[model samples]
Every structure is written in structure tokens, then in C-alpha cells.
Target: MTRKLLLVLLFLMAVEMNAQKGESNFSLGFNYGFGSEFSNRNYMFTNQFYKVQLYYRLKETKHFQYQILVQPEINFAEHQLLNFYFVKPDTPNYQQKRDEFTRLKDIREYVLNCGFLVRKPIGKTCSFYVLGSIGPMITDTETERMSKGFAFADVLAVGFAASYDKFKFDIRPSVRHVSNAGLGSSNAGYNTKNIEFGISCQL
Candidate 1:
């Protein structure tokens, strides 16, 4: 897991350097979640999800801009985000809260995804936007039964961004979905509601 995280970070740094030249803009963002009510469970703060991303601009107009990004995320505590099954309340595999906590204690997920963003500025320096992207994701797990280790993913997001000189800041709300794309029997998938906000600069 450490190696995976390290490699992702390195990749982000490389992208950062690449974005500094020509017409490209460099963006970095951090996001977290408040969970969701899904088929499996009522999510909570304990079902933590956080993401860090680096983006490079692709195109822009006075009110619209497009970009691409690579995101690295961590999902911890609530085991639901890491699993491939659609859990029901009365399932035979149900466990007490303590047991659930115990099982999730050691579980940590490291995920990487490539994505795209389409932003529209409301003002010269501030704007609202929508984003969508699909990519592949992998998780760290001892058992393949929980997940296939690799999956197809997608995200839908809306956000706002503002700039000051060469610096920029933004916030976003997003719904991220992931599925093994039928690679596993328990391919019900996972969905997370997230708020991603951050800063960027044009060079």
C-alpha cells in the first residue's frame, strides 16, 4: 500500500512539473465525504473517504474550461466502500457494530483514477463547473472475494472556482461510483458522496 501511494505521489509530482509549461494550468485538490444512505448501510463520518488530485488544463473559454486529472483516494473505517457486494440489513453475514469495527480496523484502501473536468466561470475570476470521468481503480485487500482488486469507475461532480493573480481556489460536490464491471460475483458496486475543494495556478 505504501509503495502504491508513493508511486501515485510521484506521478502527481511529474504531472505538476509538466503542467508548468506552455498553456497548461496546474491544480491540486483535496476532498472528503459525509457518506450516503445506500442499499447496504447508512453511511457516517466513520466511513471515511478522502481524495487528492492533480489536474492539467486541456482547453478553455472565457466562461468554460476543460481539464484532466489523476486522483488518489483513501477509504477507511466503513468497510462498505471497499467491498463489491450489495449488503442487505438482514443478510446472514451481518455483524454487530463492534465486529464490524474490528473487521474494518485493519482495512485501508488506496485508489487511483484518471478523470476530466469541465468548468464554467461565473465571473472573470470565479466560476461554477461540472465534471465527469471514467477510469480504472485498484484496492489493497487480502481477499479477492471482497473485491477483484481492479474495477471500472466513474464520477459526476459540480464545483466552483476562483482565481487571485496566478492562484486559484475551488470547491466541489461529487458522486463517485465504482464497479468491477462484472469481473466478480458481488459486483453490486459502491457509491460515495464527496466534497472536493482546492487551489490551482496558471503559469
Candidate 2:
């Protein structure tokens, strides 16, 4: 996990340098998001995320602007299995499986997202943007549907941003998915819908 994080940071630094060479605008943002599982997995799961974002504008037109973004985030989650549908009657230690699955567990995830944003201005102080990102993630707990260790986090969001001079405020609603891409034994993963609030300052 450390190695992966280091590589991602290096990649972001390279992009930042290139953006600087192009005399692009730079911004720093902080965001908070909360959501719950949307998948029909016979389980209850909810998560909260804290993220820091680095943005670099790549191009601009009279009506639209494009930017590249790098975000590092942490997710805190609570999960509990609500049913035994996957456990068969003939399974060994059925009672034990039920006991374990029914208990609530705390999970944590670390993610680094690199993606692009397209923004369209609605007025001088407000705009709307659509974002899509995918990144590597590390899960710190195991669950019935997802395994601990390496996975991928994908996000899609649409947001409104209002600016006051150098400061901007954002409200975004997003969908998130986490899966191992069949690299692990458990791959059912998680799907969630989230709403995020953010504040940023241009540099």
C-alpha cells in the first residue's frame, strides 16, 4: 500500500509540473462525503469520506473549461450482514458463520483518484461540472462480499460550484463503486450513492 501511494504521488507531481509549465491555474480543495450502499446484497453498509483535492486547469473556452484533478481520500465504514442467503443448509458450522456475519464491523479504505473534469459556466460566479475518476484503493477489513487488501474505486459526479473571489464552494452528488476486478476471492464489492460538500481556494 505504501508503494502504491508513493507511485501515485509521484505521478501527481509530474502532472503538476506540466500544468505549471503551461501557466495553468492551481487550486486546493477539501471535501466531505457521506453515503450508504445501494446494492442488493442482504447487508447494511454506510460510509463517510474525507478528501483533499489538487486541481489544475488544462484548457478554457468562453463557455467551458477542462481540468485535471488528483484526490487522496479516506473512507470510514460500518457494515453488517442482514441475511444468510449465501450460506447453505449443509454448510459446516452454519451457526458460526451466522454469528460472524451478523456482527457489525468497522472498515477503512485509502484511495488516490486521478481524473478529469469538464465545467460549464452558468454565470460569472457559478458553474456546473461533471467528473469521472478511477483509482487504486486499499481496504483494511474483510466482509462477506468484499475482501481485504487491494481494490479499485470508481466515481462519477455532477456538481455545482459558486465562487466568491478566490474562494469556491461546491455541492456534489456522486455514485461510487469499489471492487477487486476479480483479482480476489470475494469480488461482489460495494456500490454507493453519496453527496459531498466542498470548499476550495485558488492559488
lDDT of 1 by residue, 62-132 (tens): 66788887777776634523442324446555444223523443345566767777877776788877888
Worst 10 residues of 1 by lDDT: 37-46
The superposed Cα distance between candidate 1 and the true structure at residue 84, in angstroms, equals 16
Q: Pick the candidate with the highest TM-score.
A: 2
TM-score on alpha carbons, each prediction = 0.67, 0.86
**Over the full model, what C-alpha lDDT does candidate 1 score relative to the true structure?**
0.63
lDDT of 1 at 93: 53
Q: Which segments of model 2 are wrong by more than 4 Å?
A: 1-24, 39-41, 88-95
Candidate with top lDDT is: 2
